[model samples]
Target: MVDKGGSDTVFRTEERFRQALPDPASMAGWTPRSANAEIEEAPEPAANCGPDADWYCARIARGEANFEAVGEEAQFDLTAFADRSAAQDACRKEKTWSAKYTEAQVPPVPGVDSHAYYRNAGGLDGLNLFMCTGTVVAQVLLEGEGSSLDPATAHSLAQLFASRIHKAAAAQ
Candidate 1:
């Protein structure tokens, strides 16, 4: 889950180990009677996911233990983007690109109407996605030490961060 407070934020998840399941299609002498015969059912939620449990407990109960949150607040300087030219210059210096949007983007946040995306042009490492809601500009940074994440993963991380920021802003 994503957690943002002050200038510190993190998207993280606990590690989990699961046994590999046998592939249904590879099972010997097994065949479906009809294409519609096999109906997939949603897994049941864990017992501790009720309202009485803590947020972590709920997440764990929902089988989201393996999920990882992939952004941090302090990694991106939102104020840097106040001046578009300067931001672009910084991006250039860092071998990155700034993607500004005149229209709304996907992975929508509740309070954000528009946002900017920044990432390494070579797709190595480092990424920032920020949104302005009222006077608050929420920014999320994705830069893992010695690890490079794909654009889709970075966007997902930004979405998670933005959602948290929007929720907190709405509460205030």
Candidate 2:
């Protein structure tokens, strides 16, 4: 497990096999090379046509989809909603969803598990950006996890990480 205390970004793993957790900084495609890394902003392809479409368009127009800085010290704010209604609204606006586990039993965890899974949802070529996140860990699977890692697998990992982090935080 790796914990960035001040940033509150914790990555954990739990398996009966008992392997060491990989370093988050060393994770492939997780770290940015430099402070001057180029930021890219692109429109979401699944265009919505409704009253709220304009609101969504305005958000993208303001470069909300631009890539942010990435580094060991970089902090990615994972905001939590006080209620489901707020969360749903945010999901609708951001085009994201809570990571589902249809293939297996739900794993116990703290906070909320969410994801943005699309076969081809972003960019012109429809690049697949599948990611799953909990309060403790976030995994961005650049290529969709074919059949190797399903939603259940992602959720279970997130749950274990979140549970461990919660326990640690409470102990302090």
Candidate 3:
């Protein structure tokens, strides 16, 4: 979009993804971070698109959740894919570790196909999570003064998001 003189500021949020996105009400303390959910569609003639080219994105979504409380601040992201394989591919490509965090492998929640967690490498007080479900990719991040987001909690939250995705797909 930059090439076209457009920017993220100009991209309209699409409702097509709302059905499968994680609901803020599903978690306690944490509330909606963004005013509304945003759509993340794949570009036409997408680069490296899998068997299903009319894709939603590069990453998949997962189900698992965190109810025990992550911290004073938090956010969630959900990306949809055309098929499970495309989502799986995105999940597998997740970085082993990011510059600011150390990673840990976690088992996939109930219906999730894969999962990963990363804690602030500096012991600062934050955690980031990623997971993959049949046709969606979801992420959760909790941050606060001395806040902690355990894998089990993240898994629980992920499961909720994943179920929504499954339900939406079934409806279609």
lDDT per residue, candidate 3, 11-80, as tens digits?
A: 1224435555665675556655553454434333225655443334353222222332444455566665
Off by over 4 Å in 1: 1-111, 114-124
lDDT of 1 by residue, 68-123 (tens): 23332213222212222222233332222243422223354444433445445354
Q: What is the TM-score of each candidate against the true structure?
A: 0.33, 0.29, 0.62
The CA lDDT of each predicted structure is 0.32, 0.30, 0.50
Local error of candidate 1 at residue 172 (angstroms): 4.7
Ranking by TM-score: 3, 1, 2
CA displacement after TM-score superposition, residue 160 of candidate 1 (Å):
2.4
lDDT of model 1 at residue 140?
47
Model 2, span 1-172: residue lDDT tens: 1112312322222220011122344234444422211111453322343435422331211100112123112212222222233323444544433233222333433354444342432331112222122222222232221324344544544444344334443442
Steric clash count of candidate 2: 0
Q: Give the range of the ten consecutive residues with the poorest summed lDDT in model 1.
A: 13-22
For all candidates, the clash counts are: 1, 0, 20
Better of 1 and 3 by TM-score: 3
Candidate 1 Cα RMSD after full superposition onto the native fold (Å): 18.3
Q: Regarding TM-score, does 1 or 2 come out ahead? A: 1
